[model samples]
Target: MNNALEPSAVALGTAGWGGGWGVEPLDDGAWAEAERVASDALAAALEAGITTVDTADIYAHGRSEQTLGRLLAADSGLRERIRLQTKCGIMIGGSPLYGVDSAAAVESTRYHGGADHVRRAVTDSLERLHTDHVDTLIIHRPDPLTRPEETVEAYLELASAGSVGSLGLSNMGVAWVRRFDDALRAATGGEEGIACLQIELGLHHRGLVESAVLVNHPDSADRAVVGEAGGLAELCAERGIALQAWGSLGQGRYTRGTEQAADQDREAAAVVAEIAGRLEVSGEAVVLAWLLKLPWRIQPVVGTVNPDRLRAAAQAPVAADRMDSLDWYRLWTAARGAPLP
Candidate 1:
């Protein structure tokens, strides 16, 4: 992996800045306030040695992109000092159903399209980002209807046109990545290939680890290709591709006590709390630190409208020695509420 793509300790997530995942709409004043907060957040991230900020065109209907662009435009120096990553793929319409919404509804509402949409989207994103090019551009998710090669062709064209620096895929199985990787290699005459693969990795989704070795059936094969647990980390180690982690906190479920697996959850939380209490930090910080300890270079995508939460996540201390192998298994088992077969 190139130093430019190596995983930083932290990566700022823009989901919360632009109304936050369909929870609420930001008014003009709120949007302006978000821009200020985002700018300050980016400044702090840069100062903390975190060089990446991840956003998407669909986020707040391009408000996140606009905000990020405005921040960069405000600080001419900071713009060049950071890595920018954004994804496209999932189409959103006013019907409230994403991707699964009807074509008529999609067309009638605000429908974000596929490759063509991506092209226009990137252009708009760049304009809003106030940058000529993006360091990393990711296909947010797989378009089942579109062939992988077709998608790669579009991304390659963007790269060739100097609109993007590197290409990546997200939420795809191994087969899709391999197929896309092959397509990109073939299309670019082997000059440029995929630089990274982004996926949901955390305690809840350990399926990737299991899927890595079970390549056979269609589902298993897909898992095998896409779910290579530490393969991304190991590959990044070899090629310098950074393994960026999304949903690092497991959607806040890790913090709550639940009945389905109350004992396990509580035990794990207690273990994390115990460590955090001793270290004088939040459980979220401890969770993030644990993620950093994995074999792959991890850049956590953290979402927070709260500045204090963001700071705590950015400053989370990694206990290099406190979490032992047994303790790790204990916590994992506690989280799962059952022994690994």
Candidate 2:
């Protein structure tokens, strides 16, 4: 397939690759089955021309990372063709699971970003991913236990050792990013700060966009997703921090009807469908296209497991580029259930 857009435009997410976190595998057969499913999903992603895969160590309690490792090992040239991005610093089931002598029981997850934890986490992650260096290593979530300087120090150590090519931050605000960037420059004299920021952005989760729209209108408390002061998109644009949006599909609320579907979601779905029909594309394309047309090069992390849907997502750039500014705002306003002020 010909390259339509940049490989980073649509990143394949592997959180569901190793299978949902509900039932533990009973025996070797179950483990094999999970691996098969994970392998197939990744194969589907590749067939769709996605070269960026986003995964986390805590996903399926490390099974997700390990599966990717095995897949890379089997295929000699696949790793070189893709940009593998994985996240660290999220703790699950108490202490570190991988590299332990005993099996790790799947446990609830929470954030942990201590300097020691960060080092150990990246170490374990590299081992599981079967990679010398990941394309991008993200913090996953901010850890309150560690200060900004401590986080940068950990990142510096990893960068020096070639364990991670660069660092990214997930679910962080503009203030935290600026603070960390300043610390990074001061401590190491390195010009680079956070290279990317992964946050919730979609038809439903408009935290960054709403910050700008709802300025001076606090009463629109109903519309706040992350409650930023405003200008995150602008800041990210200025700093060249590529915004990778997770949940870019609104968790499938746009295509699939839900009981909790708000009025705006319904309206947005209608408009999206109309556009899709007019353009002869899938509704999924419409939703993803809307995000693609945003000002910045917002890479949407598509978690779809279906191969056909993955192919449709790859077609977003063509459909998205066709949308004019007027149509773009129509979808945005329909999602907000209010006209732009």
Candidate 3:
């Protein structure tokens, strides 16, 4: 059975590999070119020793998984070189379970976490991914209508069948995860449960850090409304859950020059550039390094399709080790654009 959760310091994200979210869908010719580019990026990532990859069923309307599948199929030894992870539960147009009206389904989106949807989604994801078992299966988002028991039932069944290796959750807060973990433990008799938690974390996106530091401030009340009441990194460490950060490079806002940047991003960019120069690394590495400095061994899912930038991100762990507490706070305070709370 493929039941292991061995993620590295960084995970290569394929969100932009096939391109289907908000952006216009590509034609066959363009898709072929995109896959070619993705192949090159994967090659570079492998060369850099980044063995974990993160993708989702809804990414590029399933094209991302399909592209990954084709690449792995083309190379017999490729599957063994990387730990593959994919997410389900988000239903959008182009999904096999999106009903018969394919064209109409593209105009809408929903979250489904029932037993049947979960099972079918992962099964179909396996088919698209061209793999018997995924190293990790994460629910893309929380389904408000579904019960924890229902998800646990599906997860156990999938794990037993070896269709999914490990379980994870994305875009979910600590309180909800605690409840879900409790039910998952009861279902598995405490043998298995959540192995990772994926959330938006980076220099520009510092809600996870601010969530704790702003506790007594007035912003804390506003944060509670959006489910950022505490530290996810702390919770993940306490529960032995791997904290995988998406948008770990701030989506290039800090590294991609400041000509069009907002005042806040511009300021953050200046600090990041200074730190990068001092460390003798790319700004991309400096941004990712900031997340690596956290107490938890947070794995940043670097999504850059550019091979050079991806390789730069691979250096973040080393740069992080070289960073001091003073510089770390410098970047944080610069990104926040204000004094420490």
Best by TM-score: 3
Residue-wise C-alpha lDDT for candidate 3, range 1-341, written one tens digit per residue = 55344677789999988744544557889778878988999999989988899999888777899899989888887887889999988887445445554456345687878898889889888998888889888988888999878988898899888788888999998777887778888888988768899988888777878877787788767655225427667777888888899999878999987676677799889888888899988888899989988888789999988999989999898889889999999999989888886
Candidate maximizing lDDT: 3
Please give the RMSD of candidate 1 to the true structure.
5.1
TM-score of decoy 1: 0.79
Every candidate's CA RMSD? 5.1, 3.9, 2.4
User: Per-residue lDDT tens digits of candidate 2, residues 161-233?
Assistant: 8777777888877787777667776886767767788888887777777776566676457665335526777
* Residue 301 in candidate 3, Cα distance off native in Å: 0.7
The predicted structure with the larger TM-score, 2 or 3, is 3
**Per-residue lDDT for 196-284 in model 1, tens only?**
77778765555554344444546555434344452555554555456677887666555553333255366677776676677676767
Model 2 Cα displacement at 5 (Å)? 13
> Which of 1 and 3 is ahead in TM-score?
3
Q: Which clashing pairs does model 2 show?
A: none
Query: Each model's C-alpha lDDT?
Result: 0.67, 0.77, 0.83
Cα-based TM-score, every candidate: 0.79, 0.89, 0.92
Instruction: Look at candidate 2 and tell me the lDDT of residue 118.
Output: 81
